[model samples]
Target chain A: MPIVDLANPSRFLALTARLMPWLIGATVLAFAVGLVMVKGAPDDYQQGATVKIMFIHVPSAWLAMGIWALMAIATFGTLVWRHPLADVAAKAAAPIGAAFTALCLITGMLWGRPMWGTYWVWDARLTSVLVLFLMYLGVIALWRTVEDPSRAARAAAILTLVGALNLPIIKWSVDWWNTLHQPASVVRLAGPAIHPTILMPLLAMAVAFLLLMVTLHLAAMRNEILRRRVRTLMLMQAQAAPGSAS
Target chain B: MSALAALFVREVRLAVRVGGGGGIGALFFLIVVVLTPFAIGPDLALLARIGPAILWLGALLASLLTLDRLLTADLEDGSLDLILMSDTPLELAVAAKAFAHWITTGLPLVVITPLLGLLLNLDAGASAAVALTLFAGTPALTFIGAIGAALSVTLRRGGLLLAVLVLPLTVPVLIFGVAASNAAIVGPVPFGTPFTILCALTLASLVVGTFAAAAALRQGME
Candidate 1:
């Protein structure tokens, strides 16, 4: 009965404590191989070494979109199941998503300036990405600015879902508008255009980025749980000082 | 309908006595339009080219400045509870309030646009186009911005959050609004497509965000 009752935090924490080292080990292994592949990939026939930015840019862009989707699902989960952790999951995700979004933007600029001869362009894809970056920062800033944690979570969740609705619009806006940004090359109808030589490392980096995101998400969740615990303890102490502990 | 009309009147009266939200929003739009030419360089041809877009964007930003007030005042003073309990569907009340908000903030921008258009050197045709687009576009902003307002009603600092959350969703409107005005000048395409899309965006916002916001408000009041 005691073992099955692991829904309690103390039990959950004990289990997680035992599990952390393994997750950390796996993350390190994935990143190490991923970094080597990224560094060693042949220069692009067209873009030259600047194409290496693709290794980071593609994954970060993917994660930037993926995290928002995850946050929306977490939000809908909280609204439906009233899951205690779902709110925390969303609140913790804002910064990580913002970080990936920032990485995507920075790497995108590095690639863009060299190829397009400008740091910024009003192309549909770039414009959509810029909006995504702004949305992420807004989510992060909103979560931090609010005094009430639960109110912040709900607000952030609404923002997340709203931003998620635009991801499809942004991705397709280029195709729909036929602007400067190219349509999907790697994920196209005839499959990836790049030779397997480059494709293998790109896939590896993507897997590594996902693994790293999971690690950060777990750590962020732990930090949130700790913050909540301290807040509860502070409230209890505030009440207890005027009355008996019982 | 009368019940919602009553709420709309009450909201507008409250807005007016609270220092006039829409007028201030229009003032912001005028200031942005006036200041942009010096910075972008004072070429009337260039100004004429971009005037519609600048006016539409200015309206979007200015309307954003007022969106936070939509629910914050009600939430703060406890009127939100009464609104929640009314037998009228909260969605209808949202529409009515949003309609009033548009009248206050958006109408002023539409009225004052030609005045600002002179500063930007926009011709009469483009000015008319700007007014028409702003008139169409700003309602959609209110409708969409209301959802963010409703979501962030309980927060102390929802103003910036509302802008960040709402602006991207607003791109479709801004695009078509300006495009319609541009079409008026260029004659490459008719204004029908952009104008129809703007109407569609407004309707979608009303149907979706309205109900979503009302549902959330109901939850909070409970």
Candidate 2:
């Protein structure tokens, strides 16, 4: 079937059911390979074993930012295209995105304790990420506080799009003001700065994390659809009952 | 009067008559600034050092305090529906309301900052520096708060929620406002750099807040 056919909720559910096992298997396999690679990779001369934390920390950080970008696109789907599943997708991604952001923050603190010799610093990258975490919570709170899911979704779509625009400005302003965080080494013009031996495991772990995020997101979307259906049925039952007030 | 000017006058008049606009925000700003000394002790040097930061924070919060009424008052009285169906564009209408809110609410906080700065032991130069930044910066706060105001327009008890939603987004404005004031007071770096960025942030928020709040109101009113 063409991809657009999956816009139907039932069709989407069927596709996810069919795709779930393979996705799970791949994620598990990827994580296994990544862990083995990480075990064999030599420690950094300076950081020693502490460098191993990068495998977990970096990927979660990537997912933290990546998931927001994903939600921004989903928000566009909701607002512009009026795609039925788009709001569900955006809503589902929020808490999962929040979890990854929290994981990123916690793991970064763990790493920083050894590297920066403090649990936290108001470094540009670190502070911006914390702001991102707060934004996620704010969006989720907006979703929860509004009684109607559809209304909340539209409101959240606006907030998400604005956030996507503001995020770059926040990053730039923070970087301009002060920065103690390390500069980009992986994505810079000169290319990957690390030796391939370490880079391989990092890439593997990143893929594993991506797979994990997708799996969780799809499952969460399915759950939200089911929950909405149950809500519809309950309302129907209430309306059908005897002596119900209009 | 032009349609936008009429709307502007209506908002200012309503805020003035409604009894929550003129002095409430400035009073909150004063209390917040006064509380700082009690919380942080009466050390003049330390208060002088952090004076700009305190003033910026107080203005940010006072604007948020008054932002909830920006759209809700109209929405409650059913005039928002009338405004929505009117010939003037919603974007201009939202901007007009926000500007009125700044005049009645945010402007007072700016006018009172120098006096409040004295409570923080700020010198005359430091007070003027902070007041200047607040003048340039609080419009950004009012506009940013407008987005949250519009988003929460339909909800009950939305003020606290509006604060949560808008505060993080105002970080850039806060950072640069305080930075510029500090730079003006203690000048290793030129004040022009941060002050210029502060102005840019206000301009950007004016465009962003107008469109976003208008969009939110459109979605919400349905």
Candidate 3:
């Protein structure tokens, strides 16, 4: 069987176990390099040191959105392919995605206070990200409220796919609402107008965040699979016991 | 066809009877609208400026008040299972139920908006625009809400969960609804543009909500 086969949870666990250490190492190394690169980068003429906040803020924002996208793909797996691990992957990813989203919002707030002179603005981009964060909470709440794991997974998957419609709106809300948040600079048609010095640390930090997400997601999935095993064993034990009905 | 009509009638009748404190989405709307002045003080100008938004928000929340019963009531009585088994496609049945919900719950909010507008001190034109926008926009709320209603139907306490899940999805409707009304009241922008988008949102939700709710109903039954 392929090492990355979707059918077998134990095989998936074996593969993740082998990959976990290297992933952790890479994450640590990337964070180190990213911090150094950020420190070495020159201050922006307009924003000064406040621009350094972007190193953390931008990557966290990216991961926040990226994780939801990953969950949506996993949703498809759960709904269409019935991949056993897909729900596990999504459920595991929600809190981490939510944490990253919170980090993104906080960092953006910190950055905004000095730059935009407000801790919060009802600007389109900011408002949309806020909605995305709420949507994440809603998904997590859905998962918790439903007692049946399979039913919870199915419901969560449907909700995730439905919520995916908002991603593009979040991305373009700055343009649409013409709010205070700056328009997309990095992914534009002209290809990243940001200076190379700033862009480098940004890319490095993004890679670091991605690695961190994977490391956390794998750990969560392992715990989930093990948790299921524990539940099954407990059920069997209760059923086999003589006085279990009482 | 008759099965769906009967279902629609049954839902509307339940909503009308149970809609107030026992069943009153419009009463909730009145309270929410009525309290704004007390909360914001007696600045009639400010009230007028913000009235459309207040009305839209009230309508949005009022529609949500009754959505939990959309499928849960049916599911509780095993009527949902029969609806699922019937020849009528689940999507159509879900759409019919949502429509009935709109008629019983959402329509009352729209009808009462003009009266509530008077309390907010909105002029006739502003009040008319808000009512028009709500009329076009509240269907989307009911439809979009149907999906959340279906997803949360099995839970013991799903009202808060339904609101959390459904509210974010309704942001676009709220935006365009308010924007369209705002344009009519105070705008360099034309009312037609945002109003058109609001209608498009209603149509889109009508389709997406039906299919998604049906899918959720099917999943929940398992």
Decide which is better by DockQ, 1 or 2: 2
Worst 10 residues of 1 chain A by lDDT: A169-178
Question: Residue A134, candidate 3: how far off, in angstroms?
Answer: 0.3
Candidate 2 segments exceeding 4 Å error:
A244-246
Best prediction by DockQ: 2
Error of 1 at A191 (Å): 2.1
Model 3 alpha-carbon miss at residue A190, Å:
1.7
Can you write out model 2's per-residue Cα lDDT over B5-44, one digit (the tens) per residue? Answer: 9999988888888564667888888889889988999999
lDDT string for model 1 (B21-87, tens) is 6578888988898889878999888987788878888888999998887888778788888888788
DockQ of each: 0.48, 0.85, 0.68
Please say which candidate is ahead in lDDT: 1 or 3.
Answer: 3
lDDT of 3 by residue, A1-246 (tens): 654574589888888899999999999999999999999999999999999999988998888889999999999889997776998999999999999999999998998899889899777766778888999999999999998677889999999988997556544533455566677799988789999999999999999989999999999999988988887898898898997775
Candidate number with the higher DockQ (2 or 3): 2
Task: Choose 1 or 3, whichever is better by DockQ.
Answer: 3
* Model 2: how far residue A180 lies from native, Å: 0.5
Docking class of 3: medium
Q: Estimate each model's TM-score.
A: 0.90, 0.98, 0.96
Worst lDDT window (10 residues) for model 2 chain B? B14-23
- Model 1, first chain, TM-score of 0.89
Give the per-residue lDDT of model 3 (tens digit) for B1-222.
498898888777776673323247888889998888899998999999999989999889888887887877788888888999999988888898899888878888888888999999999999999999999999999999999999998888998999999998988888889989999999968999889988988998899899989999899887
Clashing pairs in 3: B18-B22, B18-B23, B19-B23, B19-B24, B20-B23, B20-B24
TM-score for chain B of all predictions: 0.94, 0.97, 0.96
